[model samples]
Target: MELEEIFNEYILKSEQLIITKRSMNDIAQNEIKNLNQKKEKEQDITGNKNSTHSMDFFFIQDVKSGETTRYKNIRSTVDEKIKQIVLQKNKQYQWILSESFEIFREFLIKSYAYLGYKDKNIWPLKDYGSIILSEIENKDYSFFLEQTKTKRDVPESILNIFRNTFPEYKKLETCNKLDVNLNLEINLIEHFRHIIVHCGGKTDEKHKLIEKIIKKSGLWNNGKYDSKHYDFISSFFRLKESNDIILLEIESNNQDGFPNKYYDVLSDLMNSLNSVAYLIVNEIKTIVK
Candidate 1:
Protein backbone atom coordinates (compact mmCIF):
# COMPACT_ATOMS: atom_id res chain seq x y z
CA MET A 1 0.00 0.00 0.00
CA GLU A 2 1.01 3.60 -0.48
CA LEU A 3 2.59 5.46 2.42
CA GLU A 4 -0.36 7.88 2.54
CA GLU A 5 -2.81 5.04 2.92
CA ILE A 6 -0.68 3.50 5.65
CA PHE A 7 -0.54 6.82 7.51
CA ASN A 8 -4.29 7.30 7.23
CA GLU A 9 -5.01 3.79 8.46
CA TYR A 10 -2.67 4.23 11.40
CA ILE A 11 -4.31 7.51 12.36
CA LEU A 12 -7.77 5.97 12.16
CA LYS A 13 -6.85 2.93 14.24
CA SER A 14 -5.01 5.00 16.85
CA GLU A 15 -7.96 7.41 17.17
CA GLN A 16 -10.35 4.50 17.68
CA LEU A 17 -8.15 2.95 20.37
CA ILE A 18 -7.82 6.26 22.23
CA ILE A 19 -11.56 6.96 22.00
CA THR A 20 -12.41 3.53 23.39
CA LYS A 21 -9.92 3.88 26.25
CA ARG A 22 -11.23 7.33 27.18
CA SER A 23 -14.84 6.20 27.11
CA MET A 24 -14.00 3.31 29.41
CA ASN A 25 -12.08 5.60 31.74
CA ASP A 26 -15.04 7.96 31.95
CA ILE A 27 -17.41 5.10 32.73
CA ALA A 28 -15.14 3.75 35.44
CA GLN A 29 -14.63 7.16 37.02
CA ASN A 30 -18.38 7.86 37.03
CA GLU A 31 -19.17 4.49 38.58
CA ILE A 32 -16.54 5.05 41.28
CA LYS A 33 -17.96 8.51 42.01
CA ASN A 34 -21.48 7.10 42.21
CA LEU A 35 -20.34 4.28 44.47
CA ASN A 36 -18.64 6.78 46.78
CA GLN A 37 -21.77 8.91 46.92
CA LYS A 38 -23.95 5.90 47.64
CA LYS A 39 -21.63 4.83 50.43
CA GLU A 40 -21.76 8.36 51.90
CA LYS A 41 -25.55 8.36 51.84
CA GLU A 42 -25.68 4.96 53.49
CA GLN A 43 -23.27 6.13 56.17
CA ASP A 44 -25.40 9.25 56.83
CA ILE A 45 -28.51 7.12 57.16
CA THR A 46 -26.87 4.53 59.43
CA GLY A 47 -24.60 6.99 61.32
CA ASN A 48 -21.67 4.56 60.79
CA LYS A 49 -19.00 6.46 58.94
CA ASN A 50 -16.33 3.84 59.69
CA SER A 51 -18.29 1.09 58.00
CA THR A 52 -16.58 -1.64 55.97
CA HIS A 53 -19.90 -3.40 55.69
CA SER A 54 -20.16 -2.76 51.94
CA MET A 55 -16.53 -2.78 50.84
CA ASP A 56 -14.89 -5.00 48.17
CA PHE A 57 -13.27 -8.41 48.76
CA PHE A 58 -11.35 -11.03 46.75
CA PHE A 59 -9.40 -14.27 47.22
CA ILE A 60 -6.10 -15.53 45.85
CA GLN A 61 -5.87 -19.04 44.38
CA ASP A 62 -2.79 -21.20 43.89
CA VAL A 63 -2.93 -22.53 40.36
CA LYS A 64 -0.45 -25.34 41.02
CA SER A 65 -2.46 -27.07 43.78
CA GLY A 66 -5.91 -25.64 43.02
CA GLU A 67 -5.87 -24.32 46.55
CA THR A 68 -7.84 -21.16 47.26
CA THR A 69 -6.41 -18.96 49.99
CA ARG A 70 -8.57 -16.27 51.55
CA TYR A 71 -6.16 -13.40 51.21
CA LYS A 72 -6.89 -10.77 53.84
CA ASN A 73 -10.42 -9.62 53.06
CA ILE A 74 -9.49 -6.18 51.77
CA ARG A 75 -11.97 -4.26 53.85
CA SER A 76 -11.03 -0.77 52.76
CA THR A 77 -12.75 2.61 52.50
CA VAL A 78 -14.09 4.00 49.21
CA ASP A 79 -11.16 6.43 48.96
CA GLU A 80 -8.65 3.62 49.31
CA LYS A 81 -10.37 1.54 46.66
CA ILE A 82 -10.43 4.58 44.40
CA LYS A 83 -6.69 5.00 44.90
CA GLN A 84 -6.08 1.38 43.84
CA ILE A 85 -8.20 1.86 40.75
CA VAL A 86 -6.29 5.02 39.85
CA LEU A 87 -2.98 3.17 40.17
CA GLN A 88 -4.16 0.44 37.80
CA LYS A 89 -5.44 3.08 35.37
CA ASN A 90 -2.07 4.83 35.41
CA LYS A 91 -0.40 1.50 34.61
CA GLN A 92 -2.75 1.14 31.69
CA TYR A 93 -1.89 4.66 30.50
CA GLN A 94 1.80 3.86 30.65
CA TRP A 95 1.35 0.71 28.61
CA ILE A 96 -0.69 2.52 26.00
CA LEU A 97 1.88 5.29 25.65
CA SER A 98 4.77 2.84 25.36
CA GLU A 99 2.94 0.64 22.85
CA SER A 100 2.21 3.70 20.74
CA PHE A 101 5.90 4.45 20.57
CA GLU A 102 6.63 0.91 19.37
CA ILE A 103 3.91 1.15 16.76
CA PHE A 104 5.36 4.43 15.52
CA ARG A 105 8.75 2.81 15.33
CA GLU A 106 7.33 0.09 13.13
CA PHE A 107 5.71 2.68 10.89
CA LEU A 108 9.04 4.47 10.58
CA ILE A 109 10.81 1.25 9.63
CA LYS A 110 8.21 0.69 6.95
CA SER A 111 8.63 4.24 5.71
CA TYR A 112 12.36 3.81 5.49
CA ALA A 113 12.07 0.62 3.48
CA TYR A 114 9.45 2.14 1.17
CA LEU A 115 11.65 5.14 0.49
CA GLY A 116 14.58 2.87 -0.22
CA TYR A 117 12.52 0.81 -2.67
CA LYS A 118 11.59 4.00 -4.49
CA ASP A 119 15.24 5.02 -4.57
CA LYS A 120 18.19 2.91 -3.46
CA ASN A 121 20.13 6.12 -2.83
CA ILE A 122 17.98 6.49 0.31
CA TRP A 123 20.16 3.82 1.97
CA PRO A 124 22.73 4.69 4.66
CA LEU A 125 25.59 7.05 4.03
CA LYS A 126 29.30 6.03 3.81
CA ASP A 127 29.91 7.48 7.28
CA TYR A 128 27.28 5.05 8.74
CA GLY A 129 30.20 2.55 8.62
CA SER A 130 29.31 -0.83 7.09
CA ILE A 131 25.73 -1.52 8.27
CA ILE A 132 24.73 -5.16 7.59
CA LEU A 133 21.66 -4.84 5.40
CA SER A 134 19.19 -7.65 4.71
CA GLU A 135 16.29 -7.50 2.27
CA ILE A 136 12.90 -7.88 3.92
CA GLU A 137 10.82 -10.77 2.59
CA ASN A 138 8.33 -9.76 -0.12
CA LYS A 139 9.53 -6.14 -0.18
CA ASP A 140 11.82 -5.11 -3.06
CA TYR A 141 14.26 -2.63 -1.48
CA SER A 142 13.16 -2.93 2.16
CA PHE A 143 16.52 -3.23 3.87
CA PHE A 144 16.00 -4.54 7.40
CA LEU A 145 19.18 -3.04 8.79
CA GLU A 146 21.08 -1.99 11.90
CA GLN A 147 19.09 1.04 13.06
CA THR A 148 15.94 -1.02 13.66
CA LYS A 149 17.78 -3.55 15.81
CA THR A 150 16.43 -4.31 19.32
CA LYS A 151 19.53 -2.90 21.03
CA ARG A 152 19.20 0.32 19.03
CA ASP A 153 15.88 1.48 20.45
CA VAL A 154 17.18 5.00 20.81
CA PRO A 155 14.89 7.54 19.10
CA GLU A 156 17.84 9.63 17.91
CA SER A 157 19.44 6.64 16.21
CA ILE A 158 16.25 5.87 14.29
CA LEU A 159 15.77 9.53 13.37
CA ASN A 160 19.37 9.70 12.32
CA ILE A 161 18.67 6.99 9.74
CA PHE A 162 16.16 9.27 8.04
CA ARG A 163 18.54 12.20 8.14
CA ASN A 164 21.25 10.12 6.57
CA THR A 165 18.85 8.65 3.98
CA PHE A 166 17.34 11.92 2.81
CA PRO A 167 19.71 14.68 1.82
CA GLU A 168 17.07 17.31 2.60
CA TYR A 169 15.74 15.76 5.79
CA LYS A 170 15.74 18.33 8.61
CA LYS A 171 15.05 18.18 12.31
CA LEU A 172 11.42 17.75 13.28
CA GLU A 173 9.73 21.10 13.88
CA THR A 174 9.24 22.02 17.54
CA CYS A 175 5.83 20.91 18.71
CA ASN A 176 4.37 24.36 19.42
CA LYS A 177 1.35 22.96 21.23
CA LEU A 178 3.41 21.08 23.82
CA ASP A 179 6.18 23.71 23.87
CA VAL A 180 8.92 21.17 24.72
CA ASN A 181 12.05 20.05 22.93
CA LEU A 182 10.75 17.35 20.60
CA ASN A 183 14.16 15.73 20.23
CA LEU A 184 14.78 15.48 23.93
CA GLU A 185 11.16 14.63 24.74
CA ILE A 186 11.08 11.75 22.24
CA ASN A 187 14.28 10.30 23.70
CA LEU A 188 12.90 10.61 27.24
CA ILE A 189 9.65 8.91 26.29
CA GLU A 190 11.54 5.99 24.75
CA HIS A 191 13.68 5.78 27.88
CA PHE A 192 10.54 5.63 30.02
CA ARG A 193 9.14 2.94 27.75
CA HIS A 194 12.28 0.88 28.24
CA ILE A 195 12.06 1.19 32.01
CA ILE A 196 8.42 0.17 32.11
CA VAL A 197 8.88 -2.81 29.81
CA HIS A 198 12.30 -4.14 30.76
CA CYS A 199 12.81 -3.03 34.36
CA GLY A 200 9.26 -3.43 35.64
CA GLY A 201 8.66 0.31 35.86
CA LYS A 202 11.97 0.98 37.60
CA THR A 203 15.27 2.38 36.38
CA ASP A 204 18.04 -0.12 35.67
CA GLU A 205 21.09 1.21 37.45
CA LYS A 206 23.45 -1.17 35.69
CA HIS A 207 22.43 -0.37 32.13
CA LYS A 208 24.99 1.86 30.44
CA LEU A 209 22.42 2.80 27.76
CA ILE A 210 20.10 4.09 30.49
CA GLU A 211 22.87 6.32 31.83
CA LYS A 212 23.70 7.59 28.34
CA ILE A 213 20.03 8.30 27.61
CA ILE A 214 19.61 10.17 30.89
CA LYS A 215 22.64 12.34 30.26
CA LYS A 216 21.96 13.11 26.60
CA SER A 217 18.22 13.69 27.03
CA GLY A 218 18.93 16.25 29.75
CA LEU A 219 17.15 14.32 32.48
CA TRP A 220 20.53 14.47 34.24
CA ASN A 221 23.26 16.56 32.71
CA ASN A 222 26.70 17.47 34.08
CA GLY A 223 25.97 15.52 37.28
CA LYS A 224 22.72 17.39 38.01
CA TYR A 225 19.23 18.09 36.72
CA ASP A 226 19.21 20.08 33.49
CA SER A 227 17.76 23.58 33.64
CA LYS A 228 14.85 22.68 31.31
CA HIS A 229 14.32 19.13 32.56
CA TYR A 230 11.20 20.04 34.48
CA ASP A 231 9.58 21.57 31.41
CA PHE A 232 9.05 18.17 29.79
CA ILE A 233 10.37 15.56 32.22
CA SER A 234 7.93 16.56 34.99
CA SER A 235 5.02 15.51 32.83
CA PHE A 236 5.88 11.79 32.90
CA PHE A 237 8.61 11.19 35.46
CA ARG A 238 10.16 12.28 38.77
CA LEU A 239 13.95 12.02 38.72
CA LYS A 240 16.47 11.28 41.45
CA GLU A 241 20.06 10.09 41.66
CA SER A 242 20.87 7.25 44.03
CA ASN A 243 24.50 6.21 44.55
CA ASP A 244 25.39 7.60 41.10
CA ILE A 245 22.52 5.74 39.46
CA ILE A 246 19.66 7.72 37.95
CA LEU A 247 16.37 6.61 39.43
CA LEU A 248 13.10 7.41 37.69
CA GLU A 249 10.12 7.66 40.00
CA ILE A 250 6.83 7.38 38.17
CA GLU A 251 4.06 9.53 39.71
CA SER A 252 1.08 7.24 39.30
CA ASN A 253 -1.04 7.45 42.44
CA ASN A 254 -1.27 11.23 42.70
CA GLN A 255 -4.18 12.78 40.79
CA ASP A 256 -2.25 16.00 40.19
CA GLY A 257 0.81 14.10 38.97
CA PHE A 258 0.03 14.19 35.24
CA PRO A 259 -1.27 17.80 35.23
CA ASN A 260 -2.95 17.05 31.88
CA LYS A 261 -5.34 14.44 33.24
CA TYR A 262 -2.89 11.60 32.51
CA TYR A 263 -2.83 12.31 28.79
CA ASP A 264 0.56 14.04 28.78
CA VAL A 265 2.64 11.01 27.85
CA LEU A 266 0.17 9.75 25.28
CA SER A 267 -0.15 13.23 23.79
CA ASP A 268 3.60 13.47 23.37
CA LEU A 269 3.70 10.02 21.81
CA MET A 270 0.99 10.88 19.31
CA ASN A 271 2.66 14.15 18.40
CA SER A 272 6.01 12.49 17.80
CA LEU A 273 4.44 9.70 15.77
CA ASN A 274 2.43 12.05 13.58
CA SER A 275 5.27 14.47 13.02
CA VAL A 276 7.78 11.77 12.06
CA ALA A 277 5.44 9.69 9.92
CA TYR A 278 4.04 12.72 8.08
CA LEU A 279 7.49 13.97 7.20
CA ILE A 280 8.62 10.57 5.97
CA VAL A 281 5.43 10.04 3.97
CA ASN A 282 5.65 13.50 2.39
CA GLU A 283 9.27 13.02 1.50
CA ILE A 284 8.64 9.62 0.00
CA LYS A 285 5.74 11.01 -2.04
CA THR A 286 7.94 13.77 -3.37
CA ILE A 287 10.65 11.26 -4.34
CA VAL A 288 8.28 8.90 -6.16
CA LYS A 289 6.62 11.76 -8.06
Candidate 2:
Protein backbone atom coordinates (compact mmCIF):
# COMPACT_ATOMS: atom_id res chain seq x y z
CA MET A 1 0.00 0.00 0.00
CA GLU A 2 1.03 3.60 -0.51
CA LEU A 3 2.71 5.15 2.53
CA GLU A 4 0.20 7.99 2.63
CA GLU A 5 -2.70 5.57 2.51
CA ILE A 6 -1.24 3.52 5.32
CA PHE A 7 -0.76 6.59 7.46
CA ASN A 8 -4.29 7.80 6.82
CA GLU A 9 -5.76 4.43 7.73
CA TYR A 10 -3.89 4.38 11.04
CA ILE A 11 -5.18 7.81 11.96
CA LEU A 12 -8.75 6.89 11.04
CA LYS A 13 -8.60 3.73 13.11
CA SER A 14 -7.22 5.59 16.10
CA GLU A 15 -9.98 8.17 15.98
CA GLN A 16 -12.66 5.51 15.71
CA LEU A 17 -11.27 3.76 18.75
CA ILE A 18 -11.37 7.00 20.69
CA ILE A 19 -15.02 7.50 19.78
CA THR A 20 -15.85 3.97 20.87
CA LYS A 21 -14.21 4.53 24.23
CA ARG A 22 -16.08 7.77 24.77
CA SER A 23 -19.40 6.16 23.93
CA MET A 24 -18.76 3.31 26.33
CA ASN A 25 -17.81 5.74 29.06
CA ASP A 26 -21.07 7.64 28.62
CA ILE A 27 -23.04 4.41 28.83
CA ALA A 28 -21.21 3.38 31.95
CA GLN A 29 -21.87 6.71 33.57
CA ASN A 30 -25.56 6.55 32.87
CA GLU A 31 -25.74 2.97 34.12
CA ILE A 32 -24.06 3.98 37.34
CA LYS A 33 -26.49 6.82 37.80
CA ASN A 34 -29.48 4.56 37.26
CA LEU A 35 -28.01 1.98 39.61
CA ASN A 36 -27.63 4.53 42.37
CA GLN A 37 -31.20 5.76 41.91
CA LYS A 38 -32.54 2.20 42.12
CA LYS A 39 -30.49 1.58 45.26
CA GLU A 40 -31.86 4.70 46.94
CA LYS A 41 -35.46 3.77 46.16
CA GLU A 42 -34.96 0.27 47.49
CA GLN A 43 -33.45 1.61 50.70
CA ASP A 44 -36.35 4.00 51.22
CA ILE A 45 -38.91 1.25 50.82
CA THR A 46 -37.06 -1.36 52.90
CA GLY A 47 -35.98 0.94 55.71
CA ASN A 48 -39.47 2.31 56.48
CA LYS A 49 -40.04 2.26 60.26
CA ASN A 50 -43.84 2.25 60.07
CA SER A 51 -44.10 -1.56 60.11
CA THR A 52 -44.02 -3.03 63.65
CA HIS A 53 -45.04 -6.69 63.12
CA SER A 54 -42.41 -9.43 63.52
CA MET A 55 -43.26 -10.84 60.10
CA ASP A 56 -42.98 -7.37 58.52
CA PHE A 57 -39.58 -6.93 60.10
CA PHE A 58 -38.35 -10.29 58.69
CA PHE A 59 -39.80 -9.42 55.26
CA ILE A 60 -38.09 -6.06 55.27
CA GLN A 61 -34.77 -7.70 56.24
CA ASP A 62 -35.09 -10.09 53.33
CA VAL A 63 -35.85 -7.21 50.98
CA LYS A 64 -32.77 -5.37 52.20
CA SER A 65 -30.55 -8.40 51.53
CA GLY A 66 -31.96 -8.73 48.00
CA GLU A 67 -31.37 -5.04 47.34
CA THR A 68 -27.77 -5.31 48.54
CA THR A 69 -27.12 -8.28 46.24
CA ARG A 70 -28.57 -6.42 43.27
CA TYR A 71 -26.48 -3.36 43.99
CA LYS A 72 -23.30 -5.40 44.24
CA ASN A 73 -24.08 -7.21 41.03
CA ILE A 74 -24.69 -3.95 39.18
CA ARG A 75 -21.45 -2.45 40.43
CA SER A 76 -19.44 -5.57 39.58
CA THR A 77 -20.85 -5.65 36.07
CA VAL A 78 -20.02 -2.01 35.43
CA ASP A 79 -16.48 -2.45 36.73
CA GLU A 80 -15.88 -5.44 34.48
CA LYS A 81 -17.26 -3.60 31.48
CA ILE A 82 -15.03 -0.61 32.09
CA LYS A 83 -12.01 -2.86 32.54
CA GLN A 84 -12.65 -4.56 29.21
CA ILE A 85 -13.02 -1.21 27.49
CA VAL A 86 -9.74 -0.02 29.02
CA LEU A 87 -7.91 -3.12 27.85
CA GLN A 88 -9.14 -2.60 24.29
CA LYS A 89 -8.16 1.07 24.41
CA ASN A 90 -4.67 0.15 25.56
CA LYS A 91 -4.31 -2.28 22.65
CA GLN A 92 -5.31 0.45 20.20
CA TYR A 93 -2.76 2.81 21.74
CA GLN A 94 0.03 0.26 21.26
CA TRP A 95 -1.15 -0.47 17.72
CA ILE A 96 -0.96 3.22 16.77
CA LEU A 97 2.66 3.40 17.97
CA SER A 98 3.73 0.18 16.25
CA GLU A 99 1.84 0.87 13.06
CA SER A 100 3.18 4.40 12.81
CA PHE A 101 6.68 3.01 13.08
CA GLU A 102 5.92 0.41 10.43
CA ILE A 103 4.69 3.05 7.99
CA PHE A 104 7.77 5.16 8.71
CA ARG A 105 9.99 2.15 8.02
CA GLU A 106 8.25 1.42 4.75
CA PHE A 107 8.61 5.04 3.71
CA LEU A 108 12.35 4.92 4.44
CA ILE A 109 12.83 1.73 2.42
CA LYS A 110 10.85 3.11 -0.50
CA SER A 111 12.70 6.41 -0.41
CA TYR A 112 16.03 4.60 -0.52
CA ALA A 113 14.81 2.40 -3.37
CA TYR A 114 13.66 5.51 -5.22
CA LEU A 115 17.19 6.87 -5.00
CA GLY A 116 18.46 3.69 -6.75
CA TYR A 117 20.21 2.38 -3.63
CA LYS A 118 19.00 -1.18 -4.12
CA ASP A 119 21.70 -3.34 -2.65
CA LYS A 120 19.14 -5.87 -1.35
CA ASN A 121 21.89 -7.01 0.98
CA ILE A 122 21.14 -3.76 2.84
CA TRP A 123 17.53 -3.54 1.73
CA PRO A 124 16.45 -1.63 4.83
CA LEU A 125 19.16 0.83 5.83
CA LYS A 126 20.29 0.87 9.47
CA ASP A 127 22.40 3.00 11.78
CA TYR A 128 25.61 1.15 10.96
CA GLY A 129 25.17 0.45 7.28
CA SER A 130 28.67 -0.70 6.50
CA ILE A 131 28.89 -3.00 9.50
CA ILE A 132 25.44 -4.41 8.75
CA LEU A 133 26.48 -5.07 5.13
CA SER A 134 29.60 -6.87 6.35
CA GLU A 135 27.56 -9.07 8.71
CA ILE A 136 25.06 -9.70 5.92
CA GLU A 137 27.91 -11.10 3.75
CA ASN A 138 28.32 -13.88 6.34
CA LYS A 139 24.68 -14.29 7.60
CA ASP A 140 21.73 -12.65 5.79
CA TYR A 141 20.07 -9.27 5.28
CA SER A 142 16.85 -10.44 6.98
CA PHE A 143 18.74 -11.22 10.17
CA PHE A 144 20.28 -7.72 10.29
CA LEU A 145 16.93 -6.07 9.50
CA GLU A 146 15.15 -8.10 12.16
CA GLN A 147 17.51 -6.77 14.80
CA THR A 148 16.53 -3.18 14.01
CA LYS A 149 12.91 -3.54 15.13
CA THR A 150 13.62 -2.69 18.76
CA LYS A 151 10.61 -0.81 20.17
CA ARG A 152 12.45 2.12 21.72
CA ASP A 153 14.87 2.54 18.80
CA VAL A 154 12.41 2.41 15.90
CA PRO A 155 11.25 6.05 16.13
CA GLU A 156 14.80 7.36 16.30
CA SER A 157 15.84 5.13 13.43
CA ILE A 158 13.00 6.42 11.25
CA LEU A 159 13.77 10.02 12.19
CA ASN A 160 17.39 9.45 11.30
CA ILE A 161 16.34 8.21 7.87
CA PHE A 162 14.23 11.33 7.33
CA ARG A 163 17.13 13.52 8.34
CA ASN A 164 19.57 11.78 6.01
CA THR A 165 17.33 11.68 2.94
CA PHE A 166 15.84 15.16 3.17
CA PRO A 167 18.73 17.07 4.64
CA GLU A 168 17.26 20.36 3.40
CA TYR A 169 13.72 19.63 4.57
CA LYS A 170 13.32 21.75 7.67
CA LYS A 171 11.41 19.90 10.36
CA LEU A 172 7.89 21.25 10.67
CA GLU A 173 6.97 22.83 13.99
CA THR A 174 4.19 20.29 14.52
CA CYS A 175 6.55 17.40 13.83
CA ASN A 176 9.13 18.81 16.24
CA LYS A 177 6.49 19.19 18.92
CA LEU A 178 5.19 15.69 18.21
CA ASP A 179 8.69 14.24 18.44
CA VAL A 180 9.09 15.68 21.90
CA ASN A 181 5.61 14.74 23.10
CA LEU A 182 5.78 11.22 21.73
CA ASN A 183 9.15 10.60 23.33
CA LEU A 184 7.71 11.34 26.75
CA GLU A 185 4.11 10.15 26.40
CA ILE A 186 4.79 6.99 24.41
CA ASN A 187 7.46 5.88 26.84
CA LEU A 188 5.10 6.31 29.77
CA ILE A 189 2.20 4.60 27.98
CA GLU A 190 4.45 1.80 26.79
CA HIS A 191 5.60 1.15 30.34
CA PHE A 192 2.00 0.76 31.48
CA ARG A 193 1.02 -1.10 28.32
CA HIS A 194 3.82 -3.59 28.92
CA ILE A 195 2.48 -4.32 32.35
CA ILE A 196 -1.12 -4.40 31.14
CA VAL A 197 -0.44 -6.71 28.21
CA HIS A 198 2.43 -9.02 29.22
CA CYS A 199 1.89 -9.15 32.96
CA GLY A 200 -1.92 -9.08 32.96
CA GLY A 201 -1.98 -5.51 34.27
CA LYS A 202 0.32 -6.33 37.15
CA THR A 203 2.61 -3.67 38.58
CA ASP A 204 6.35 -3.92 37.90
CA GLU A 205 9.57 -1.99 38.40
CA LYS A 206 8.39 0.85 36.17
CA HIS A 207 5.27 1.22 38.30
CA LYS A 208 7.43 1.24 41.41
CA LEU A 209 9.47 4.04 39.89
CA ILE A 210 6.27 5.95 39.25
CA GLU A 211 5.17 5.33 42.83
CA LYS A 212 8.49 6.60 44.12
CA ILE A 213 8.14 9.77 42.09
CA ILE A 214 4.61 10.28 43.39
CA LYS A 215 5.76 9.70 46.97
CA LYS A 216 8.66 12.10 46.65
CA SER A 217 6.31 14.72 45.26
CA GLY A 218 4.39 14.40 48.53
CA LEU A 219 1.04 14.49 46.74
CA TRP A 220 0.08 11.26 48.42
CA ASN A 221 0.57 10.50 52.09
CA ASN A 222 -0.15 6.82 52.72
CA GLY A 223 -2.69 6.99 49.86
CA LYS A 224 -4.88 9.17 52.02
CA TYR A 225 -4.93 12.35 49.97
CA ASP A 226 -8.25 14.08 49.41
CA SER A 227 -9.72 13.57 45.96
CA LYS A 228 -9.20 17.27 45.28
CA HIS A 229 -5.47 16.78 45.82
CA TYR A 230 -5.32 14.68 42.65
CA ASP A 231 -5.26 17.83 40.51
CA PHE A 232 -1.54 18.48 40.74
CA ILE A 233 -0.54 14.88 40.27
CA SER A 234 -3.00 14.40 37.42
CA SER A 235 -1.70 17.49 35.65
CA PHE A 236 1.88 16.35 36.11
CA PHE A 237 1.03 12.97 34.63
CA ARG A 238 -1.07 14.59 31.84
CA LEU A 239 -4.15 12.80 33.07
CA LYS A 240 -7.68 14.21 32.96
CA GLU A 241 -9.71 14.52 36.12
CA SER A 242 -13.24 13.22 36.16
CA ASN A 243 -15.97 15.85 36.39
CA ASP A 244 -17.31 14.37 39.62
CA ILE A 245 -14.99 14.29 42.56
CA ILE A 246 -17.12 11.71 44.33
CA LEU A 247 -15.93 9.17 41.82
CA LEU A 248 -12.44 9.26 43.28
CA GLU A 249 -12.26 6.84 46.18
CA ILE A 250 -9.40 6.52 48.66
CA GLU A 251 -8.46 2.90 48.70
CA SER A 252 -6.51 1.22 51.47
CA ASN A 253 -3.44 1.16 49.26
CA ASN A 254 -2.80 3.37 46.23
CA GLN A 255 -0.85 0.63 44.46
CA ASP A 256 -2.38 1.11 40.99
CA GLY A 257 -5.33 -1.18 41.42
CA PHE A 258 -7.24 -0.01 38.34
CA PRO A 259 -9.19 2.82 39.93
CA ASN A 260 -11.93 4.73 38.14
CA LYS A 261 -9.55 7.68 37.86
CA TYR A 262 -7.58 5.60 35.38
CA TYR A 263 -10.46 5.79 32.94
CA ASP A 264 -9.82 9.51 32.71
CA VAL A 265 -6.14 8.83 32.15
CA LEU A 266 -6.90 6.34 29.40
CA SER A 267 -9.31 8.78 27.76
CA ASP A 268 -6.75 11.56 27.76
CA LEU A 269 -4.09 9.25 26.38
CA MET A 270 -6.37 8.09 23.58
CA ASN A 271 -7.15 11.66 22.58
CA SER A 272 -3.47 12.57 22.61
CA LEU A 273 -2.53 9.50 20.61
CA ASN A 274 -5.06 10.34 17.92
CA SER A 275 -3.84 13.93 17.76
CA VAL A 276 -0.21 12.86 17.48
CA ALA A 277 -0.98 10.34 14.78
CA TYR A 278 -2.71 13.02 12.72
CA LEU A 279 0.16 15.45 13.19
CA ILE A 280 2.74 12.82 12.27
CA VAL A 281 0.89 11.99 9.07
CA ASN A 282 0.70 15.63 8.09
CA GLU A 283 4.38 16.06 8.83
CA ILE A 284 5.25 12.99 6.75
CA LYS A 285 3.28 14.35 3.83
CA THR A 286 5.11 17.65 3.93
CA ILE A 287 8.52 15.97 4.11
CA VAL A 288 7.78 13.42 1.41
CA LYS A 289 6.58 16.11 -0.98
TM-score per candidate, chains pooled: 0.71, 0.47
lDDT of 2 by residue, 180-245 (tens): 333334444544444445554433243354554344334457766544433432332332332111
- How much lDDT does candidate 2 score? 0.43
Model 1 C-alpha lDDT per residue in residues 1-289, reported as the tens digit of each score: 5677668876776676577557656766886788688779979998876466344557899999999887765577666667566656666666666777777766766665556556655555542245534433234432333433432544566577666655455444343444545556566667677777876655445344545655765467567665455434443443343211122123355665555233344554666666666767776676686
Q: Give each model's whole-structure lDDT.
A: 0.59, 0.43
Candidate number of the best TM-score: 1
* Residue runs of model 2 more than 4 Å from their true location after superposition: 48-124, 127-152, 159-180, 204-208, 211-264
